[model samples]
Target: MLFPVALLGVVLAAVAHEGHVHDATPDTVPETEFQSWVAKYGKQEDLPFSGPLSFSHLPYAKCLEEPDAKFSVAVLGMPFDTTTSYRPGARFGPFGIRAGSRRQRPGRGYVLHYGFNPYVSGKTILDCGDVPISPVHNGLALDQMEVAYADLLRRPIANEEIDRTRSLALDGVEHPRIVTLGGDHTIVLPILRALHGIYGPVTVIHFDAHLDTWPAPPGIPAPYEAAEITHGTFFTSAYKEGLLTNSSIHAGIRCKFTGMEDLEHDVEMGFALITTDDIDDVGVEGIIKKIRDRVGSGPVYLSLDIDVLDPAFAPATGTPEAGGYTTREVKRILRGLIGLNFVGFDIVEVAPAYDTNAETTATVAADIVHEFISMLLFEPKEKTAESDFRVQAGRNGDEL
Candidate 1:
């Protein structure tokens, strides 16, 4: 039995030999040249997706184990969900996100307004595959993830020349930015540790329904408290460790809290809260301004919990909140943050088992990441020719 033509294209692209990929100017080429290039280039073996399964059919490699290839944006999957408080299936979030992104292959849906296909943005992006973790040991799992992320972030940025002999140390080399497909909200804790090793404490823009800053009850000892290192307590732990700055803020917070102190404790931890109701009060523009004003000009880490979307829009997350932002609203808000100093990002808590036939949840997660990569590669004032004939509306800074 043959796979769907699209899936077959992805499989071939992944296992293809290196050095056969084309650097085409899709927007600038003549019609006859573009058609010839597509037909001939379709058979080339050296292309993106060098591994068996890559996100959005991009190149795939284990950067930590093999340093031969160079990359600028590395996508790593964290497939551990041991610490989830409400549901347990987010261990499969990475797979679901990757599967949903397959539709973006053959450059079909690259947003024209963004002015670039991330795959062809003259930057190297590789799917570094998923990190290995022991399900039985949360502490050990956390340690392994932190170590893996640190190794990836310390890698030197890829240049035109492929230098296989270069050391993978920070050693005055610029590091690649990372976009992680998360197992759960808890995964952000280890990611914070790894990023702090390089960029120091970062300002976080956390989008979630729950605060995730709830502290463990008092009177617990060391070993006992270790058990409290869960999804709900990660932000509190992060604040205590000084991995995040006072400029950190939470958006789409509508979860039930114990009382006024929960909000006060979060404020003391350096977070400004934006409830679901705020979406109506401030509108998307006002919300965008608030985010910019809060994050300022610091290295920013964006952690998006899928539950930030209303259950109507995304019902496949572990904790489905009823009142939350719609997918369109969230996308518009994210687009507004373009050009900010972003170091890393993650969209967590997608559990495909709970999804509808439309696969609404996983598709939204993939779309969010697509916009993220586009934002990462965005440049101001570069205009594509009118005869470029790309699909979709042209995006300007204020148009969206």
Candidate 2:
């Protein structure tokens, strides 16, 4: 059975081995080349999936035909949104983001594995499916999440995360990379919980409208309580729980939801605040440099709450700020951090219900994912040129 090498979750590269799999663009290359590459790398013993490989046909969920890793990235969709204020549809964010991410220009979308072609490179990514959730049952969801993630966290790989550094390795797959598509900022807590347990005291790059540093505030009636373990209270708990390196370096904060005490507590707790006003003063390049300087060479987990995109760009978030970076600017800032010690990122708070035009939030989130993969995966100038071309949108910066 053949698999669709769509994204880089689990790849299907064209090797010169018999019985290997291959995915090639229609009419782009001669059909003979596909078979040739397969003959080289497609060994029957090295296949990722076998025996009536089912579920590999699902749009967002698929099993690899041959379980081998070439720097994998697991993109888990955690669409559970039990705690939200003023917005209730972010549970749809992950699906919306995936739906909008199907971009394949005339030539592109493959480089990391199979030089400038997806089929040749294989999809170097994996969809971990949605994190087990209970949309209607909060406690149950948390319980299920605790149990499920406890299983993940308990894996011996979590103990040596950086050494392994790929979800495939953690999941006992070959050495593959991992990227998480989040349902909310709170999802970062569990990821950090898993990561921190192994690579203790990693620095966090937080991009959001609010500080999210409030201790468990009183539970509010609608959406969420300021203090619940929902989206809003996640960071506070993380700091207390010691997930972040004391929750340091929060960028793109335009609005303040927590009191000054919490704010001050966050600061004393080692959280560095980067205001929208400051970002405005310094360009994204400068801001990224500042963040890199502060963080130095720590293991980085980027947490991007889409509300930072000023309501004009990302209005679907529960907490939208008036003045913030344009989506382009946010991409630029993140671009500068490319090649830095970045582990993974979560673009949270995209409530599709708020956006009458689904493109508004989905596009932002998808673009974020694209730019992230572009920065994290794509190799440098000459290599990228020789590699497959996806979109011609001119991305300039460091590359491996």
Runs in model 1 with CA error above 4 Å? 1-51, 159-173, 218-221, 382-400
Flag regions of model 2 displaced more than 4 Å.
1-71, 104-107, 110-123, 146-176, 218-227, 257-259, 380-400
lDDT of each residue in 1-400, candidate 2, tens digit only: 2444453324433233323434434667555886888889883421222222211212234222212312344556677777775667777777777655545221344433213432223344445556768878765665555454434334232112332234322344322234556676677777777666545667888888887776665645765533378787677777787767753698888775535776777786578888888876777767976787777556677888888888888777776779988887887677566555566667787887777464777767876776665555544434333212222223431134
Clashing pairs in 1: 14-49, 20-46, 21-46, 49-58, 49-59
Cα lDDT of model 1 by residue, 207-320, tens digit: 999999998757788776667788888999999999998999899999998999999999988999888899898899788778888987777889999999999989998888
The number of residue pairs in model 1 that clash at the backbone is 5
Model 2 alpha-carbon miss at residue 368, Å: 0.5
Find the candidate with the highest TM-score and give its number: 1
TM-score of 1: 0.81
